[model samples]
Target: MSLSETQPDAAGARRIARPVPLRESVYSAILDMIVSRNLQPGQHLVESELALMLGVSRQPVREALQWLKNDGWVDLRPGLGAYVHTPTVEEADQLLAVRRLLETESARLAAQHATEEGVEHLRELCRQGFAALEAEDVATMVALNAELHATVMRLSRNDVLVELASQVDRRVRWYYTPVARHRGAQSWTEHSALIDAIAAGDGDRAGEVMHAHTEHTRLSYLEQQNLEKSGADAGSPARPITGRRP
Candidate 1:
């Protein structure tokens, strides 16, 4: 199943499941495109075109666009339809900082609770990440990066932490996508150190490694912004959020 139904219902049925709703799947598809940069930032989202592309009708596209707007992923202009939201530096920094805090704690806890199987899993993921990096497969690298972090969070064995991570994980993927290739080899190297710390059951070392790794990603993004600013000379300014509509 695309969606995992791990929790039991009120009646306590085992692994109760349902097919993911079409609206949600469509929303995810559009969001993934945005995260992957397949749909460029600020590019207009035509409902009919999206419907045709995703093999869905216009209604789901319309609903998905609205949902994206509500979630700050897209903007629905009065007459101009929908467009992807271009993230600003301030926004990225804030979210990445939050990610660092949560993930650092997860790493610490994972080190304390690491099992043989979990450590092996982390190593397997690390190998795959290195392979992706070697093959110059940014998309697969990004996905595997997520999977590795998710595995660490799982090893933490904290349901609440996992849930919180899941909430921000999609946005993290969005922010990390640009920096994936930029941090490719170094990122995996950091992952190797983190895995070693976990395997050694050194909570402090694992926490420190994870914290540094995430901070590096954030700093790299800032460097990229600097390069972009220099390239643009007179960079098109980001639109400031306002209290009242123009």
Candidate 2:
């Protein structure tokens, strides 16, 4: 059944009652699909196919497309359907710069403000991420990594920083997914260090670690992209596809 139909009371009242709105679900689904490379960059999104895949009506998918367009995730055409937006190198650099600034501050604040419980939560998330990686569960690792970051952001207790970090985080995830598998354990090792810095209340160290971590991620993604392009230029059609990092 469709999400709207599943919420009989809300559907009857013509309202959404969940913590996450229907539009947000649609938006997230589309974003995940794109990030996971199920929908390739510059690939067209057929409305009917999306509706069927998402188990919703065309309305929500259309609404999601509009939201994605505003976020620069998709481009809407007059005659054709929506297409995944391919970010330029300059755009990627801009996003990484903003992300590094926001996340470094978040890590610093989290070091100062994180409670014991918050630290424990982050540890659990890190453990889960490691386990996911060991199991080759790339999707789970991606989700757990997001949870770890979200936990740290919440520990900072700064709403403005949280919001800004979330925006940059999403964009980074979009770029990271296609190249995550290449870097593998190195990513998780950095995450562990960030958690350790926060646990020790080392604000400056936390910030520095986070900055390096994000910078490394950005560089790795660019390198992978360049490697792929070179392979294509060399007419190597048998290059292996790498999974994205968590």
Candidate 3:
């Protein structure tokens, strides 16, 4: 029943799928830690410690660290080892703007193509998100928010758009994790409107709703940065792209 045990061979016979290598698994683990802020910005990454913590060998850890460096997630100093990359305001803004563009298009497409079942599914997700909000479960709210967006992307039914969105997805999660709690009720309210537009099959309305919804998040992040700047007068620097574990 495992993915690695269920793949079909070239001749169409069943064969074990090649299991993912340890190095790739380690890479994914480290990436999750970074995205969740368990490995914070500028925090030193000790390979031996990470290997031990992850119950893996140093070889895979080393390989994963190198991969992280290539992906701009971890910085490897010439002699000082590795550290998590400190996300900048400019970087966050740029990435978020890209997400907004992609999601707006997705909303438009979803409205054009949405089925009744798909719209109902979106509404169910919206309800779950609201319930999470009511429970003040930021983690669940954040996850449900992601699922809602992903469902919209799927409903869009554009492989090219989905591919482009996939590229930006993790980065978007990294940025949004910090602001999720702050987004609160208004975020779900907007999701409701977006669902309504899709249900109505109003592509223009769907796009408009998504555009505004994404802009709210962007503005909120900017405002958060501004607040941090205000507080930095006492010498505490603004730390952008914070995360919390679910």
Candidate 4:
């Protein structure tokens, strides 16, 4: 039977429909693996192995890899096959720069538009994030952190800004995941200040606080990368800041 086409049943009497296209299923599985860091940066993505792991055939896996390549999640080497995209410093910088611009505007607008209830929602997310941090539950903390930022963006009441933020949102989470544990207490502390600025309806202050807050995360990631590289160059084991692979 052709992998991308439907096959007849043994009796040749019934048609079975798939819930989703095989290629899309493969694509989602692979992307989830990438986002979860199970497929680490620069890791080889072998189609046969991926197919086997995902319980699909190689044809779907191949198609999914092509899609992933187009989406900047995979790199198809001319001769060496596909690998997860290892983001360059330039790429990271450019993305984060754009993120800062969008989020700064969002924060400023959020301050102008935030209702008391909206501010309280942010506060609740902040509290949950801090609690997760204290418990050393990095996953929950990261999720809560995302929720807090998303709430602020929503409170901005600008659909255009929200849409733009959504575009880079997943990639931002991918970049943020590795360092979430490291940011810990300090991140939530920044959120607290941002919440205060928003609550006070200080657009300028809110923007300034968010700008600084994001820069902190960007710098933290860069610093950690530098340390890892230094360790490698010095012939020492490169210990991750998070102490465990995400």
Model 2, span 1-246: residue lDDT tens: 896778878777876566987778999999888876668777899989999999999998999999999989999999887999978777888888888888899999999999999999898888888888898877777777777878888998999998878767777777777656655688889999999999999999999999998898889878877887788899887353424333
Per-residue lDDT of model 3, residues 1-246, tens digit only: 755556545435555689999999999999988877677778999999999999998999999999999999999999999999978889989989989999999999999999999999999999999998888777677778888999999999999998999898888777777788889889999999999999999999999999999999988988886787678876886564554434
Worst ten-residue run, lDDT, model 3?
Answer: 237-246
User: Over 4 Å off in model 4, which ranges?
Assistant: 1-19, 237-246
| Candidate 3 collision pairs | 4-17
Instruction: Give each model a TM-score.
Output: 0.86, 0.81, 0.89, 0.86
Which ranges of candidate 2 are over 4 A from the true structure? 1-25, 56-60, 77-80, 236-246
Compared to the true structure, candidate 4 yields what TM-score? 0.86
The segments of candidate 1 whose C-alpha lies over 4 angstroms from its true place after superposition are 1-20, 234-246
Rank by TM-score, highest first. Answer: 3, 1, 4, 2
> On a 0 to 100 scale, what is the lDDT of residue 60 in model 3?
98
Residue range 1-246, candidate 4, lDDT tens digits: 563356435435555665998899899999977876678888899999998899988999999999999999999999999999988877887888899899999999999999999999999999898888878887787778778898999999999999999988878877787888888888999999999999999999999999999998888778767787788899997553332334
lDDT accuracy of residue 34 in candidate 3: 86
Least well predicted 10-residue stretch by lDDT in candidate 2: 237-246
Candidate 3 residues lying further than 4 Å off, grouped into runs, are 1-16, 237-246
